[model samples]
Target: MAKFPLSDLRFYAVDTNVLIHDPNALFKFEEHRVVIPMVVLEELDKLKVGTTALAADARQAVRTLDSLLGAATPAEIMSGVAIIRAGGQALGTISILMPAQQSNLGLQPNSNDNLIINDLLVLKQSTEVADVVLVTKDINMRLKARGAGLSSEDYHNDQLISDMDSLATGYHHVVGSFWEQIEAIEPQRVSGDGYHQMNSATLQAILERKLYVNQFVYDDKEFVCRIYKEVGGLVTIELLNTALLMRQKAWGLAPRDLFQGMAMWLLFDPEIDLVALNGPAGSGKTILALACALEQTMESKDYRRIIATRSTRGLDEEIGFLPGTEAEKMQPWLGAFTDNLEALHAEDFDPGSSADYIGAKVPLQFKSLNFIRGRSFQQAFLIVDEAQNLTPHQIKTIVTRAGEGTKVVCLGNLAQIDTPYLSATSSGLTYMSERFKGFQHGGSISLQGVARSRLAAFAEAHL
Candidate 1:
């Protein structure tokens, strides 16, 4: 149904944010024609002046445009150039829409949105593309385009899942009995490593095709199993020690529920390279990640340091202008980690001092995403909070920086995404989680319930 929104449009005029969100968006339309307004190029040029991630994206978009349109003459440019991928597959055609004569959109040119709407209006008048669509990430821009008698749509090509509820919660929760499908078990490995071989083709029918590797399956009767391997019709499930999982501790923290337990299992597992935690506002995502990070870095000595970061609107443009050292500027955005640190040490006589001491003791560094490009980290525990605000490209840029022996944990509340361009289904957290669902070294869990406070939980439910 998500794919139903985007009918293969013959002609599409893309907005600047769409290109920024995915720099290679021009070539993704698959044999269709893509139109880039001259004003959009000008907007990208202005955004290219900063060192932020936005600036990087703008520069990349401009570079892609140049690479495609550089050798073309005015006549050929007026027509269109074939869009080719880096893998040498030719798909669509891209052309620039120049400034048109006075348009009848009746909107002032005080904003870029108005200019694009006016340009599209003029283009529709001159050309037979009366159904030409404006692809954008702005809701108000789409509304304005409609008011101007132009068709507009959201950039939904990268939205993998149509519905948010269909997205996996990193586990399969069954009602009555799920073990009835199991026919045989290997007693040797079952006693030694908790491994059990079963026919998952039968289980897939039972669960309706939600099963994947590294996903936990549990029933109401206290049965818990984690799928580590899936070979054709046969599936390998490692029965989990529920008592040990419930009693799992990182630093001084414990899982509030089985879902949180599954999340922490992925966090502490030496095999999992990426762990994603999705939940509501107070579901202990940050606290759990912080606890595991501390346990691994401080006690286990598995990692060298901890890098904390997040993505928020206006953070890229304004972080550099803030007064203070890099750490001081990042402290405001990273206050959640420190706040959770206080939570971890709340039972101490002096929780404030304990948090401070732990902060000083652990090699925890709060860094901004602005300067994270092109840098690599080895033996590091990278925690990316507010991951739902990230675009698919932006998250890829961050996750690719992990060197060998590094683990990344992404935490986000899809219910509270503050970015204008992202929704629960289109978030980078959702994108990465969907893309990495079957990765052997990756796991994700949706932490249920609100663990903040009675008032917070009440507000989460009623508000």
Candidate 2:
């Protein structure tokens, strides 16, 4: 699994952003040396003060570091301390790179990043160097490190895919009849639903990648089937009527495209607990998700309420300064939901009043991501918007807050991520989709095309 090991182990000096991005990254480097600079510790100490997600991560990183260094003396810490795993197996050595005094590598004073680079430069020339490498999430820092004549790389342990185009789209689109590729199948009817059981190896070329329970296979011959069960090299496919799926509706909203139609089926079904919807702007991601939430909550009573939150920069810092309740403060960030609700009820006799009535009567709540931390929601539809902006660690923290009977819908356009130090391939949304690809109760659909307007669709394809 390792790229290279044994004699090729290099010293990986992690940056503050890397630690904040993932607290447990210290132990991820197996059998290699991990170095933490003194300036990094000072930065962590200064940041670990607030209840914000960033502060929480800082505190966790500090705690993890403190726990790892347990009772090591200053001299031993400077030399190296054995980094032990959870099972008490010593895998690698971790040490603090002391401040460099006589090194000529120091840049302009007062910047922790420059100071860390200075210390790393000195360490690179020391006897302990197998090959010095700086691991950082900051692109500019990586450039600076390389400019200062040092090895550097981005944190890739959590980046599952190397290319964004290789990401799963949750469905296989076949132009011809799907049965043309299948050699044989055991067909059955379960309580009026058509089911087919076939050897997975027979459909290897059609499937391409490994088959998952929630993935779909559709053909232009008016055939659509989902992999509902897989056991002992055989897959049980639940056949879905293409016409029926295209007619699926939620909260008086009909899908504009086949992708939206498929997404609505998955989001409306209580059997699936997590649905990841990603596409370009105006691909009906929010509208479809909101419609499904309202349908399940207000109409079917499947959920008690809808809890909405999104990843926006400076939300944690600016939300506390706003002059209202948490819901009121979050209203600005969650305008997409209200905006889509208005669209959903635009055909009503009084759209404004209808939207207001639902807002007043329905239990729709806007929550801050900061407040969502550590809180559990039961029988709730939790929509996490702009998930592409979240780190793998932050998304995991929020998703784990789901209590029994709660369904979490993560929506984002990977190409539209705004968060610094994140890429389409490295985004939390992509990470979650990849990690949950095989989950029996989770499904992801990368909605295709811009379904907003002719102008928007033209711009999406051309501009």
Candidate 3:
């Protein structure tokens, strides 16, 4: 762990989500005098009234404040901790600045983000007597804070994996005589620490050779064994015959959507028991996974059912009382699922049957990270979407749910978006990629291209 220069700091202005990520943040900064910039408290208050994960976090922050202030006014500065009601006047180590009287300064209209920025500015001006650091997880906000001459930093609550190469160490790259030698051995079942690391060409070769279990092959002089093991087992997707051809046609594509093809190959591979997909927005992570599920369920009948799930990290505020059964409550968060289904159905799939299977073919299940406890899945093609929002702990919860004959596909964009405490490198998707890199059944591919639209790709790059 890196040591922070905490001894010299007198005031630390904490961002709302930082506290929400870990409620014990108050005690984490124990010895140092901390300031909950009034604006942050107001933001927490607004969050507390909602039903989303943020609301739950906000309520926790309020409870912590109540413990400190003992029913005092919301803006009261008690003890060394000052709870400034955002926009209220208070003497503290930081001042909350309102938006400068200008509309063209890139401030979004009626955005609370603007208020947070203004508050940070005020706190920066007021803290002239001490060193002040504005902490936030937002990249744009960090950029803006730097532009104003304020010392700023990412919250560091969630970070990406440090070693990128570690995500591919499990699969052996075969060439020359070794490749031919393995082809000759023709193992019936092949297992490695990370099987997903193998390219589609290698997988296809294994499938064509009809190799059985206990077969051994050599990569050069290094001997590799064919041990049958299941990690995240094969994901059977039912897709249109065209979709299957599209993937088979894209064999060995090395660019943005390569992961899509890779995932498709894994779904078709009988040897691979587990596969993981990690990428950013417009990377075709979800689309490919959905297509694979469709193909397997409708065509091969390889798996009993396709199970799709996403962590409801940021569903909405006041979601607990949304007035509906489980399916109805899930409508809003499952919009992405619906959109992906609609696109797949457009490829000449029967819409009537597709609707019937929307909740049945690839049953989209809305499960929070907290609800994954005490569950086991078997013989299922499982797809975990939006995996970037999950923490390492949360990822373990979902992955461990895999029972016999279950292949889990974790899909998410490392960049473009994340949850409050997660980032591109530190998210569960990256964690799994790195941790399971050496496993024979586990595979990971980073998606880079935007297939949604030309304008979407342009916006992702330029805007």
Candidate 4:
């Protein structure tokens, strides 16, 4: 399904942010004709002057355009350049829509957006295309295009799930009786490894409700939770050690709710390489991840260091080039890190040594996504907070950097995504959770309970 091509191809007018969000969106249109406005190139030129991800995407889009139209003549560019992928495979036709005589969009001639709309209108009037659809990520741009009597749509080629709420929570509750459900299936001793296996028919019966590997299944009647581990063709269920989980405390923090306990289990698992946590604000996502990372790095001595990072994109702030060292520059964006550190340090009243001790004991390092390329993190516990602001490409880049013996935990609230071009469904956090749910070394959990103060929870619900 990932490599499926579009069947009903049509002329698609792409916007600047669409190209910036996915650099390979040019080739994603399949056999359809893609029209690029000249003004989009102008926007890309201005955005390509930075070291940010947007700049990298803009440069990549320009390079892709150059590679597609490089050998073509001016007349060919006017008509269309055949879009070819690597290895010289023909995919589709791409063309540049140049500015012509005055258009009648009733907007100012100097407006760049109106000019693009006018170009699309010109194509609709002159070309034989059955439909001219403007594909963009900007809602306002789509509204304006539709207001001008032009068809518009969101570019959904990069989205993993159509609805983010349909994602798995890595857990299910079995009501009524637990023994009644398991009495009929006799557990066969698969090996001497303390794991009993269920028969194929029993596994099929369990899978009728759809269970993922390493997903937690709980029974309220029996007050037991088991971790479903699929091995060979049979399903193995292990009783969750709730007593051990309840007795454990990491970095002076404890799981206050059952969902938080589930999150902690996934976060601290040595076998699970990637853990994703989603919830609303004050759900203990950041705090629990930091606590587990600190435990794994400092107390358990499992990982060498804890690397904490998040997308610097903000709703009301921008991460412009600042005048300072790396640590000094990233200080503003590490407020969550600072807050969690303070929470951990609140247990100690010793002012002088408490801060220094936490810093020295927890081998933690802060990183910016800007300079994370071409780097490998080995024997490290990497926590990516506010992951909802990242694109799927950025998440892929970050996760692929994990060398051997590295665990990555991504935490975020889908409702709080602040990135310009990302939605709850299209965010990297949602994409990762959907794609990694069935993997043996991956687990995800949705933390529903808010662990913050009463006032905060009230505001989240009523305000």
What candidate 4 gets wrong by more than 4 Å, as runs, is 1-9, 86-88, 184-194, 199-208, 222-228, 314-323
Order of models, best lDDT first: 2, 1, 4, 3
Q: Which pairs clash (backbone N, Cα, C closer than 3 Å) in model 1?
A: none
Per-prediction RMSD in angstroms? 4.2, 3.5, 11.2, 4.4
Quality of model 2 by C-alpha lDDT: 0.87
Q: What is the C-alpha lDDT of each candidate?
A: 0.86, 0.87, 0.57, 0.79
- Report the lDDT tens digits of candidate 1 across residue range 184-284: 22212245667887677666766777578999988877788898888877888888856768999999898988888899899999999999999999999
lDDT, candidate 2, 1-463, per-residue tens: 1122334568899999999989999999999889998889989999899878999999999999999887899877876799989888998889887788844455665688888888878777663427889999999999999998999999999999999878999988876878865644433234554787778876666666778888888898888888888999988888896887889889999888778878988898788999999999989999999999999998899999999999998785458888889888888899999999999999999998998899899999898988777888999999999999999999999899999999999999999978778999989999999999989999999999888899999999998
Off by over 4 Å in 1: 1-9, 86-89, 103-106, 181-192
Winning candidate number (lDDT):
2
Listed in order, each prediction's TM-score against the native is: 0.94, 0.95, 0.53, 0.91
- What is the clash count of model 1? 0
Against the correct fold, how does model 1 do in TM-score? 0.94
> Tens digits of per-residue lDDT for model 3 on 1-463?
1122334655566777677655545554434456666667777777776435455556776787666566454343423534343365333332222334433433453665555555545544544355666666667777776776666776554443455544432233235455464457543343443332233334446434322221222234343333233224332111222233243632122223333444566656655666766654676777777766666666676677777667664443334557786557767776777787776666455876766666564544555443445578887888887777776656776789988988888877666444655666667677777676546666665556678789888888888
Task: List pairs with backbone clashes in candidate 2.
Answer: none
Enumerate clash totals for all models, in the order shown.
0, 0, 48, 0
By summed lDDT, which 10 consecutive residues of candidate 3 come out lowest? 234-243
Instruction: Name the lDDT value of residue 301 in candidate 2.
Output: 98
